[model samples]
Target: MKQYEYKFSFLPEAINDCEKVSDLETTCEVKGKYPCPCCCYNTFPVPKEDAIAYICPVCFWENDVFTSSDDEPSDENRGMTLNEGRRNYKILGACSQDMLIHVREPKSDEFPK
Candidate 1:
């Protein structure tokens, strides 16, 4: 029963393909503009995904950012609209900031657990 969740994101000074990480172990990886993970102050990665309704007037909390094949975007990570035109649905954050590596959960469950 290990479930520690913290949502609030950013980290995109320049994203082409998309993929950023920071769980903070030793520190030093957060490129350009910082302070986001609920740090309050916002807006860094913007090229406009065509008004996706980003509502978060400091923790009103209604933005998923992106990257969710499955892991709960909460509200069950919703669905529909794949962003076929591109921009792949914003949010390139958290690829691995802490906990280094290890994932087996329900996908089959058998690895070094």
Candidate 2:
């Protein structure tokens, strides 16, 4: 698998207010610019009440759901298999204390490679 590094940021005030920094709720203001692990495609992040799951832009399947092992498929994973080619689908990443604010181009001064 290829490794992709991206920068993430969080407001100090937001971090301080949350009981658990990793559980902070996020609202994707951009609407449709989330990261896509497969083929490095750019798309919207999957939204959830408390968290988001990282999804493939082209495949429209959650990363976890897409990468699930074949032997132990759960109900959720089973559902994902059905919509592997839908458009406008998204997936959220694992919850973390650090929330990503910007995704800049490589070699840019704001986000150096």
Per-prediction TM-score: 0.16, 0.23
Q: Give the per-residue lDDT digits (tens) of candidate 1, residues 1-113.
A: 99999655675465589556666544432121221222123331332232143432222222344634333333411332223111222232212222113211111221112
Instruction: Kindly report which residue stretches of model 1 are placed more than 4 angstroms away from their true locations once superposed.
Output: 1-22, 26-40, 47-60, 64-113
lDDT (Cα) of model 1: 0.29
Task: Score each candidate by Cα lDDT.
Answer: 0.29, 0.34
Cα-based lDDT at residue 83, candidate 1: 36
In the range 7-68, model 2's lDDT, one tens digit per residue, is 56663434455454352365333334434433234444442222245533233344444334
Clashing pairs in 1: 22-97, 23-97
User: Candidate 1 versus the native: TM-score?
Assistant: 0.16
Model 1 poorest ten-residue lDDT run: 103-112
What is the alpha-carbon lDDT for the whole of candidate 2?
0.34
Clashes of 1: 2
Model 2, stretches more than 4 Å misplaced? 1-30, 46-57, 63-75, 79-113
Clashing pairs in 2: 8-100, 34-43, 52-92, 53-91, 53-92, 54-91, 54-92, 54-93, 55-91
CA shift at 86, candidate 2, in angstroms? 14
